[model samples]
Target: MGWTDGYIAVDWGTTNRRAYLIDGAGHCIDEFEDGMGILSVPDGGFPNAVSEIRQRLGDRPLLLAGMIGSNRGWHEAPYVPCPADIDDLVKGLVRAGDHEAIVPGVSFIGDGRADVMRGEEVQLLGAAAAGLLEPEALVCHPGTHNKWALLRQGRIHDFRTVMTGELFSLLKGHSILADLLQGEVEPNDTFKEAVRHSIAQQALPADLFAVRARVLLGQARKEDAASWTSGLLIGCDVHIGLARSSDPQVHVMGRPELTRLYATAIKEAGREAIELDGEQCFLAGIHEIARRIDG
Candidate 1:
């Protein structure tokens, strides 16, 4: 069947994949998620994976996004350079087969830096399409490799990636503070205070060491170090993301758990934080792609 009437959309990533079925009416009828990401697919197993997805979801055509289009994934989809919109993404789609195609990622090169992203583009553009974001907005998509993007007139103008989450992991599991940075990072006073200190001090390794100093001085608890570190990392991230933009609000798009922490940091930085549902944004972006294909 032609994808114009109906299709399956897969927000396929590295370690996990989420799939949705859109009916002929353009409504998402059902969805499912699993650990069958690109990395899980054995070499040359993408075709089989596609077959299984079709069997499970429907016989409709497929529109895939995320790392599934990366070099190590099924097929390396081209990168649509900024500024790009949903239509640009559609135009850059790479066909792995007649029945299915992969959505391309976005690339930004400027200011003595180059940034690239795979899966977050769909949600970023989708947030605009879904009416959850302003025409001109600063979007923060939190993850192991967090993304900060500037949306200009519903297109991705430019973006940057901060490995805050990765840094947290490295510091927690391998660094000298490994034993202290344990437990889930929560949005509490300690965290917000650390965020404030981080912004005020603008000192890194210096501010980071405060966790130990506070503990040694009996001013903080071991269980709270994770929160403080999380705050510091996210605080620095928000500071960088908001440095040039005059926007007073930040759109935090991701899982609620991560978004909550980012929202706290954003507020501590004196900016309004608005949370956007990642799944809805992903579906909206996929639908926008479908609209272009059908047009």
Candidate 2:
């Protein structure tokens, strides 16, 4: 999946987007990110949006990933089923024209359940294609909707989504404990303690109320509520993710700070944590796709 030719790769999401210009030397000659997400574009404005993006990056062939391929994006790139690889993604590419296309999302259905992911497929399969992941690895991508993907023989075998980040957002913004949980969530003793309680109990709804009650009862500081709530949610997340398989080491891919937090939570639950930069993985995945397309 190593690519040397030049191209423009866009990871378009809900609130922001980033575009990279890769050159013949395999270096990012130029790059920029802005708030031109799918939600920011006006009705029927995607054509203009694409122009704006290309103007910033280059006239190189456009390859868009993330939510830009969703039903709400420029074109609805259907999901490729699990046990997929880079070829599956390239085959699923929804082209608008020659050399202009949107990378599709990935879907998994089984055990009477269903799940889907858009921007993450690139990273998941990218990690594999770049040889950063093992054949029997359990990968964790933490975000608004955290994804835990099971890789079997270097293909995305199956995956599940956890809403821990969104839950924390709701709790910190709209929930009854909003005011109490406003402190910075450091990876301190409080966070680890909350994670342990959550993983052992695995009852997050019941655990969240403790954030308010503990503060009110003077048993815990309100300043610690944010960390506590984060731990509670992520603890439950790790608990369930680990239950899927006995994968002892969890490869967490994301921003350094966020990945560190998840790593702490994972380690607290008696598992190993390996952190990978999210942007690096994305670029690796994009390069893999670009190789398949331009080669």
Candidate 3:
């Protein structure tokens, strides 16, 4: 006999929780989302959120990833040692609540150093299945905390985190520029001009006096200032990320629009970029987690 049933895959992050009803073949049937991130949960909120998801889907096997498996989450699943292959991940599975099905984050400890990932880790594995991984490759995942990782021989070697989004938000909301450009004016040539200016320098100068003064002196459009600000920041980020090597295989994973913009910039700098579907990658992570756990 064959099994015919639905399973739930949940990617619960810090500010949001999303659940999908998937079949045995990893096809999504129904989906639901709520603002139930670990950060928003108020003591024992995990159980409540899990119950809500269960009620919506009825009785089904459940798998999860993201901060929900962190120490600050409902339950902390210890890290699965890395460079963990399939066997390691399978051995680390843990339930979400009661007999409710759930898989935990895998941890890797090597070289006297330790690292951890929740959901995205599994997603990366799925993307790599696209056959982009080789003996040497770089994967960049952009978001609030942009993650750049190095993979070799089918194993994640190391990674770095950048606070680009958070830094940009803080500057725009709390800096002097906030007062100067509160209401919508219009972003004109100033933004593109900023991109050109930043890209030209090869390295951004510490002094940003010119960025504002140019606008104040009527040299640049006031409305375009924000866009220019955005370009400069993003450009610098690209420059820094590509600083180490000229590897031809650069896989970018993130929001489509932003990734497209980054890809454009990268191409202009004579580099080709392969984009990974963010949503699919998220779902793929759950599937990969389940596979690893089952294996």
Candidate 4:
């Protein structure tokens, strides 16, 4: 489809939109990301936001993944059902203007329950390409709402979603955790130690006051306390997911260092840990959609 020009790939999440102008072989030539996500823009702003980016590269064809295809984006593409095949992905894709395409999210619908995801599905495809995920692998994606999916033969067999990160954000900024460090800068060790105690205790509920008690009682510290608080939150999420599933291998998705810490925690919990690059995996997902559609 191209001999003289490059293609565009985008990872459009809820809070940020990133676009890359890439050569035919997929090496990025130029890139841009701003706070123009679905939540950031007004209705009918997708075309303009995308036009701004395409104009940067002289109006090239663009493939997008993430919230650009959500109900809040340009067009609301319905989630393709789980145990979903590649054709489902191809069919669920939403097109913008003429040349820009948005990848569809995935839905797990069974047992009278329906859970959907926008950007993470693309990331999972990318994870598959990166060789970190397999058809039967159990994957954990940590984010505003963490997602765990069971894939089989390149299809999403089933999945679960947890609002772990969002809860952490709320508890930290709006609850007792916020008051514990009202005037402090950061609590590095405090955060780490909180992670340890949370893991040791096997669970942590949404008791913000208890979080303060742990610190006030000298069980934790103020410096870097955010880490400990976050660790406890993440640990609780990990523990809950583990209890609900029998999957043996755990793969952590998102920030490498954070995933590393999760991996370390998983190891301490007697499990194997694996890591995947969140951004690159999302890119691979865009390519995966391209492969299925262009084929």
Candidate 5:
């Protein structure tokens, strides 16, 4: 199929950026990725960056999501409050440079705290449109900052953010736990065991020291510490998400490896989990937005 008639959809985050050239039929024709995230862009350079990308991919209509729409991004797009649907998101789109637009993030204020998310809203919209999301569904988008969202009647009811991934990184790189971890950790029996432990105990700070003690006492290998730590954090995230949700089943969106880990943890908690491809959901959401804009 001729892909030259496609528009560009970009998922521009803090550390990296991904762009998809999608055809009129909503199929991705070409894709590109780069390390030039919002944080990397120099002041007043976003327009030039867009021009450079356009030169590589042609001057198609560009729609951006994620941190690229934040106050630190090319242009700040104010957040659309929660209980927002596809239509609300579509209406909230903010125009940028010529032929460019930024999707607004979603915000929730409740329980004496406020939460916000950007790129995941597109994924949620795609999931809802594809019939993958049920009424009153609990959707988990696992990443650096894991997002647990509640969807009611095709609208995002509320959500919570867990910095599990970020915390894991800090522990593995900066904390005393770093000394015990060796190499990349895979999701294995040790990981599962840690998940079960976290779920059962429901106390992370109290258990973290046990990891170090286990390694020092030769009860657990240093090589297994990373996986163990990963499991504990993920398990805690899932446990908290489930406890806050009234729904029994969860819809998880992420890469296969990450989602598998989350699914394993959810299953260990005796809850149901359905995995959805993150990229696909984002593309579908972009297509949906494009359609609504065109109409």
Candidate 6:
């Protein structure tokens, strides 16, 4: 009665792809990773990539999520609107190829804007199924474009995106701050202090130039600028997300490093933060969908 009794789960994104093979007991028997992301696949190359993986893992049914379901992927799966649960996702699955299905992303229209998420919906569903998500919760998924979703009764109600990570990358790699943050600096009181300042001030554009100013004034070291900038951007994101929600608890889902930063920022904001493994939530979400379909 296990959900993934005869299927493999694929979380394909822009830069990397991960595949998990689950047995009848819902245990992952094998896993694979590669640089075969959407960006790496050329014209009509998805089938070849799938074939390569299938050759090694056997021709089990494929359940795909993430950018693989977008317009740039093998097949375009239309997004299902918010207030959706695992059942809605199961109903929205679109056929991509022989014995392969793509989970539809989720879309939300609120605050006079339209936002959509592809793979994170699966993670959210998985978190809900795993009993990690509370009945009413504010979930944060930190990445290039961090997502803050509102969950009510185990269904996604609304969400928003913050380009904090992408902005940090642009600043550290191409902007004026690049020279100051050319190297890494471990997080310290400086970083935490920056987070507190940014959250308290809520003035990012005005404060960003301070990274260079502090270095020029000998108030902060050039090496520490990276950590300071990271804290500022993440703090701004967390501040904004928390401001938008009345929920007192925050669920953070992402890599350990990123989640650690988010948890710190959330704590600085006087809210409780719970960390959840992104991979576990993603696989659980695929299984949740499959379970509903099988029933």
**Residue 225 CA displacement from its true place in model 2, Å:** 0.6
Pick by lDDT: which candidate is best? 1
Candidate 5, lDDT over the whole model: 0.88
- Find the candidate with the highest TM-score and give its number: 2
Q: Please write out the lDDT profile of model 5 over residues 1-295, one tens digit for every residue.
A: 1223568899999999999888888888888999999889999999888887778777799989999999999889999998899899889999996578899999999889899998999999888887777767899999999999999888999999999989888887889888876567677899899999999899999788889999888898888888898899999999889977767788999788789889888988889889999998898888888888777
TM-score of 5: 0.95
lDDT of 1 by residue, 1-295 (tens): 6877799999998899989999866689988899998889998999999889888987999999999999999999989999999889988999888878899999999999999999999999988988899889999999989999999998999999999988998999898889898787889998999889888888977878778998899988998999989999888888888884889999999999999999989988889999988988998888888878867
TM-score list, all predictions: 0.95, 0.97, 0.82, 0.87, 0.95, 0.95
By lDDT, the better pick of 3 and 5 is 5
- Per-residue lDDT of candidate 6, residues 1-295 (tens digit): 2345567889999989999887766778889998888999999899998888778777788889999999999999999999989999999999876578899999999779899998999999799988988768899999989999999899999989899988988997899888877676445787788889998898899789988998899998887888888888888998889976877789999887889889888888899999999999997888887766668
TM-score-superior candidate, 2 or 3: 2
Candidate 6: clashing residue pairs, number: 0
Model 1 pairs in collision: none
Tell me, what's the RMSD of every candidate?
Answer: 1.5, 2.0, 3.8, 3.0, 2.2, 1.8
- Give RMSD (Å) of candidate 1 vs. truth: 1.5
Tens digit of lDDT per residue, candidate 2, span 34-110? 99889999999998998887788767788899999988889899999997989999999998767678999999999
Deviating ranges (above 4 Å) for candidate 2: 1-5
lDDT of 4 by residue, 1-295 (tens): 4422457888888898888877755567788878887798887677788778878765678887777787777777778878775567778777774677777788887867779888888777667765668766778887888887777887778888888778767876787677654443222545455556776786577434576776778865565466666767766767766664576788888867567666665655567878888877876666656655555
Error of 3 at 188 (Å): 11
What overall lDDT goes with each candidate model?
0.90, 0.88, 0.66, 0.72, 0.88, 0.87
Which ranges of candidate 1 are over 4 A from the true structure? none
Clashes by residue pair, model 5: none
Candidate with the larger lDDT of 2 and 3: 2
Q: What C-alpha lDDT, on a 0 to 100 scale, does residue 115 get in candidate 6?
A: 92
